[model samples]
Target: MSGAETEPGVLVLAATPIGRVADAPPRLAEELADADVVAAEDTRRLKRLTGELGVEVTGRVVSYFEGNEQRRTPALLGSLLAGERVLLVTDAGMPSVSDPGYRLVAAAVEAGVPVTAVPGPSAVLTALAVSGLPVDRFCFEGFLPRKAGERARRLAELASERRTMVFFEAPHRTEAALEAMAQAWGGERPAAVCRELTKTHEEVRRGPLAELVAWAADGVRGEVTLVVQGADDVPAVSTDDSSLRAAVAEREDRGMTRKEAIAEVAVLAGVPKREVYDLVHKSGPGEATP
Candidate 1:
């Protein structure tokens, strides 16, 4: 076997700046200049970024995006097996983060090729840092479903997620997304809507989810990153008959129907719906039932 064939290749996952060109790291430029092959989500955008940085890519360039990732994986793997240093980059942020590059990484791992990263700017971290919310423990939820029902169902599934959550959203859908979040996680949930982060016209709007919904209704522009506070760890109330009645009464006061109140109270109390229903009925007007 030739020397190149005997040697294992390296896969470098390079992170590009989300907005500001200056955020691109020195190592990123070095990788782009020296790699045997550069697989980018958008070769045009990659060219533009390199121009802005005044760096010349000496390596062969190829497209590696969602549309062509599957067909391109094997060829990229072939390069790696041939001991070619393959560099991966996406249009923005880190690769494999709501972007392509994951499949290539998986393939490289399986083939026993060495893999490393040249971490740089990230929309997720940039938004979280500027959001002013608790970031000590957080989760990155890339993007919500495009359809209304699917989106709502996804939000509902995360209604009780206790970790601070971050999400990327298109400018056009910001208003609808905020509105849905308000409905699922309660209107009063604290959140921040970061727009055009790290670039000119960057704006970070922080407030209750309901207020943000109204703000977005007026319309918003630019890429958006949403940071939401986790569910409050409310102490579990007693599940006794009196507690169930109180819970039901609270929901009723909030405009819920009696049937709706009973169902919600059962969920909160971790009891059967029938038990809550019987308790609500047994407690007659002004009748104290413990």
Candidate 2:
């Protein structure tokens, strides 16, 4: 192997401030000013952040967002292989949580490149900390499905998740998303909706899911992160024929072929695939699915 290949450059995943500019770590400026290349989700946002930090990025800056992450991974990997320090920063929070950099990071690791991070602020952790929910054991579920049926199914799959859950949602969809959560998890479930965290107009609404849904009905704005209470008691995995059939039907309704839906439903519910197929067809009278 060539020396450059063996001594591949470092990939620094820097966490930019999710809200307040002061939340950016001191090393973030140093790394931004020193790296050979800086890949940003939004170059304009990076420029604003750098200005706020009173630091200038001396490296080459390139756009690296969802649209071009796949197309650009190889080029960034080349820079890493060529022994250049490449720093990656997203618009807010860490990269790859629900952003770009996963592909590049994975490629760099495959090429034996050194990968490091400048951990700072995170919306997931920030919301969780102030959520007043159980933080001892929690899970980041990212964003939920946008479509209603798909969203309901996704929530169903996580119905038994015992760990506190965190989810990101768009400002416009906040009300609808909360309404779905109320329907799936019950109206009384406790949750918190953190909006524009750490910013001047930041607000954290804590209450029952039902109440949140009602409050959001008027409309919500800014970036949103929800912290929800997990099931206090893990419910029994539904094995009833009616429950199983309904589960299969939902997936099929979402465009999955019947066979595909059965298999998926079986795996998701931990039931035998054959059973789902059989019971789904064993309707007595008006139980036909159409």
Candidate 3:
């Protein structure tokens, strides 16, 4: 309890190397050596990392992983409340993104402990930079659902998502995820699959979802991040009653009943079902509003 006094408790979330240790930021070593407690996703990995960095950690070290996050966060926060600097580190990348640091961060923030980040190597941005997709407006979708049906349903929900999307996935499931994407977002939509980013064997494959599905069938290895193009803007439709009638009629031509066709068209067009019905039933042909 006598490490220091009158200093605010700071919770530092440090980002470690995703692959090559050489990529570690110099401040990471300084923080590890000086921190009062080092909470790591894997204590063994932390030990190895400290050995590589040649930093002597004088403070206590504890494991904070998925299995024990709920139990460990409070203990770490307790240390913070005692005016100790608790540094959080993961096996790779930043501490929180798809990692174990988020819960602790949330707790620390709620407890009024100052939270900061030692930003360093990041697989999300690394993959997105090399993905050659639109990065200006993109969303990070950490990981897709593991089950086949759930995964497909999740992708379907994003069918009309306008921003570029990013995802992290297991090597073995890459093909299946890409196949589902192709079926949901059209086979020709552009996408990129980045593998082993920032490592020696880093690979970036870019093309349509269908091509990626076929390519991944041969097998992929290492960590994977996927970036996908957004939906192209559709041609503007007349707000008149005729356009709605035509939309419904087109759906009915494909064997759907009037009600079923309206529902399907509304989904496909990303509009309300009630709006489609009103447009077809209320407004006549060319006089509809735009």
* Weakest 10 consecutive residues of candidate 2 by summed lDDT: 248-257
Model 3 lDDT tens row, 234-254: 344444556766877754543
**TM-score computed on alpha carbons, candidate 2:** 0.87
Would you list the rank order by lDDT, best first? 2, 1, 3
Task: Let me know the TM-score candidate 1 reaches against the reference structure.
Answer: 0.81
Which portions of model 2 miss their true places by more than 4 Å?
1-6, 237-273, 281-290
Error of 1 at 65 (Å): 0.6
**Candidate 1 Cα outliers beyond 4 Å, as residue runs:** 1-5, 234-290
- C-alpha lDDT of candidate 2 relative to the true structure: 0.88
| Model 3 ranges with Cα > 4 A deviation | 1-8, 234-290
lDDT of 2 by residue, 1-290 (tens): 64532578899999999889989999999999999999999999999999989998889999999999999999999999888999999999999889998999899988889999999999999999999999999999999999987787777666657899999999998998898888877899999999999999999999999999989989998999999999887533378888888876765554456676677678767888888878978867776443
Please list the C-alpha lDDT of all candidates, in the order they appear.
0.88, 0.88, 0.85
**lDDT for residue 209 in candidate 3, whole number 0-100:** 96
